[model samples]
Target: MTDRDADAALDRAADEALALFADDRRSSGDRRESHVRRPQRASDVAETVRWNVADWAAADWGGPVPQDAHAADSVSNGASNSSASDSPADGSSKGSSFNDELFNSDPFSEAASADRPAPDDRSRQPDSSPEPNRPPEPNQTTEPDQPADVPNEAPEARAHATPWRAARTAAARAAQPLPSVVRPLGEALGQTLAEPLAALTDLPSFDTSAMDGWAVAGPGPWRLPSKDATPEGTGTSTRTSTGTGTGILAGHAEAAPLSDGDAVRIATGARVPPGATAVLRSEHGKVRGEGRELYASRHITQGQDIRPRGQECRRGDALLPAGALVTPVVLGLAAAAGYDELTVTSRPRVEVLVLGDELLRAGLPHDGRIRDALGPLLGPWLRALGADVVATRHVGDDPEALHTAVSASTADVVVTTGGTAAGPVDHVHPTLRRLGAEQLVDGVQVRPGHPMLLARLAPGRYLVGLPGNPLAAVSGLLTLAEPLLRTLSARPAPPPYRARLTEAVQGHPVDTRLIPVVYQHGDRACPLRFHGPAMLRGIAAADALAVVPPGGADQGAEAEILDLPWTADGIGISADTATGTITGTGGTP
Candidate 1:
């Protein structure tokens, strides 16, 4: 059958089963009792109920059963007693209330089960002997004694019973589509390439000297006559030397242009005059008659000390591809290539709003008011990412003020710190919803920044809600802010490096933990002391954030976390073997 038909069939079957159960509960007066509890063996019940609506959903849809499906099954099967036992006086007349709750609790369970593979037909059913009078024993064998050669439990069965696989299967089945791409580079960094730039001229356009010396003739055996040599001797000896130094040669008596045997003094980076082919250093040459007369101690060849034109880059070549980031090095290269201005991607504008009435601007805390940490914290971080902070406003916890601030800002990204929780005072979440923002990550399974929210305000505009706590705000920025910046800038996602943990860390099994850490070497990373959302001091002191992965319940487990450097510019980790010093490169590592 088609997918739709299969899904409808599964839904109908599940509804019928639920309807049958509801009818049985209504007809029977024993409302407090569990469903199908008779002399029926637990194994028989388990086998009969194993492939519930979720299993059918798995078979119909395509993947393994979802976690929520199991949760829904547990709740649906367990809630029978509570719902059935309620009397008319107790206000339990709403039969659909229990179904509604179960349905709402897990919307995808039925769909997930329909997607899963069908159960094996070879499996035999267990005997149905009721054990309602006796308590269920843990890990009890219910199957009849079989042949010694035939194994009761298959290895595959044992493997399929793991929770991790179930969770992974559920996660895979419930995967959502990736968000649409927007102007990624423009939002984060203010700089963008106007067009693809090609080199107009070669680097070091002309051949230049690299040393302070005399540019002379070819490699040689030089015979220098005395400066006071006889006129006849001068002519004969000079003639002999002239024939040997046919090319540009050293001067016999004084440093002069090559008339026959001449050498001109040239400094480093000085242009080599015509006829000059090699360089003879002053230190290596002997000055016999005052400083004018010189003799070469070592031989040299042509073009030995010259830096050739176009050695680094050629003219008319592609210097930087279009859409490449215009960094300091790129700017320098462009300038060196004789370009005055570079056309780049436009910088994305960002506006920050700090919301809360309890936030104190500065000075000692008065009464119950705390100092505003977001203004001092996020502003510089945003700027470092190349975003132009158009405005920063501190608004009270009033939803109207927040709406006003957000509406007034013309920035591409509007970041609001505080009031994201479910408390009565929390208003950011509701305000964002009212503004028609599409939530990306409603609430990440993370500590510190658990309340952090990501939403798209417009095509290119984004609204990021940060937790009110100082550390939580920072964590939120690292997790979402940095990624948003990169997306806005159109920069590629950075690759991660492996680092050994210096100390053991413990965390909740459900939440992903972000710990402040300092990378000692390029490979060794250690967590900083005193790290938490409320602790601003610890965040300020941290060099990089070490991300502890999800499921960190065990101590001493190695974590693979994104390394957020202190500076938001880029990854900065420098280890000097000579000095044994570690430095961050100021970006995501």
Candidate 2:
């Protein structure tokens, strides 16, 4: 059936189910408006029921859904208590409510079971093709223990939010670009250009020699002035009796005009003298008779070894447009094009607040206190991610101190590590509540870092709360902080890339999984060990995070990869592909 037809069918089915429920409710004297006043728990259950009905309706028509949706259906369908109303007045209603029946009695199942196709009916069946934009139904199994139609429990059911979706939402909300600023070319590295880099004047500005050669007016057998020669009929050596002005060095100006058949010694990058037809290599042109005569052994072309004006670019040419990333090479080009400074999108100034009193600043972990890993890691990582981290302060779990620090800070982004959860010392949420901060992302479905969050502290300022675990914090950084920073800095998103998984990666039943992976030969991504949310070993050695979809990916399956900022920009990590270990000046990531 076409998608339109299926949608129509589902709509009709929904109307019929609602009508049946209306009749049942009327018979039981249950007011529909009572649902609105139900307790929060009951309201949640009712919503789940509605979702389950929608699932069965979709399933009856054979539409596939994402695992998260499917798991919700399973939870709803397993509810044996089929009561539309749980009021004290209606103490018992043994029969299934219309709502419950919709979830339990799938219409397609009944139709298929009650009317097995007759031999004659089967012969007359028409050929069918899948409707456009309609996903083919997954093959269902009928295992007695766990029916094929029943979906597995979703991993997301236990988590607070989905990682990628939350990140995208945060980026969309903070879509405004930061203020622009003019910075010296050297300081503009890693910034996004706010204006096009146009050449001030034509490159070269004049015809110049491409190499150290003789500037010739015409074909060789050209004669040089006897003053440029020695008296003994031998060519002038490096030590010439002639003045320095006689031979052209690079940056030579006020050069004597060349006449027809005249040759002058020239150096690389020296402007060709006016009236010169071409340049001949010093070795190619034989200087004889005390340099009085120069003979070209090989024929010379008009433009050979000469760089004409505007060879690289014409005057006022746009070398790079706005929104381009200012790399070292771009800075060099801007400098060469006569640009002393560049107008670039300003970096969001970020202040990192490392929470948790349990975190130790130095020395190995003694007692229960572990060394503060994020304090050292976040500042540099934030810089690489295009934020200027103003300060990284260790704000212990004191609520008053955290509040004071946050209220006083003026940075565009406030990154708080740990204390996102509602534990005894978790003051981030309370502080944000006290400050009236707007929550953007409260938590994520990602493993090892489900407690990560994003909040808007003030206009043009945000707070990204990362879980205390090291690896989980890393996940939150990439998932939330990176996208937000990129948007604020007006940097374009990097194009998506995918690679085959060299090994199997266990997937979250519903949510997406981001696993630390090193890219291998043959464009394959190898999942690293020690990938627990608390462990940093895998991410430290990883090249990128392979985004495995809801269902686990088998070996050789294609997986989308999220490249770490350092991987693409060559920040701290120097990746040795052969050894599959990344090294940096200060060590690994």
Top TM-score prediction, candidate number: 2
At residue 38, give the lDDT of candidate 2: 12
Q: Give the TM-score (vs. native) of candidate 1.
A: 0.59
Stretches off by above 4 angstroms in model 1 are 1-195, 219-261, 553-558, 566-589
TM, every model: 0.59, 0.68
lDDT of 1 at 343: 60
Go through the candidates in order and give each one's C-alpha lDDT. Answer: 0.52, 0.65
State in Å the error of residue 86, model 1. 52
In candidate 2, residue 14 scores what lDDT? 41
Q: Which candidate's lDDT is highest? A: 2
**Mind sharing the TM-score for model 2?**
0.68
> Residue 118, candidate 2: how far off, in angstroms?
35
lDDT of 2 by residue, 1-589 (tens): 9755655554444444334433443454221111111101212343323433332232121122223333333444564333322322122246746433222211223322244232123223232442345443332112211211111222332344655666666655665899899998877888899888899988988898898767889777886755534322122333443321245667646466788998877778877878788888866867777657888888888888999999999989989889998888888888878889999999888888887767776688877677878877787787887877777777766888889988988988888888776556778888999999998887776655667788888888898898777877887888889889888888778898899987665454345667878877959888765565566766787799888765457678899888888878843222223312211111111
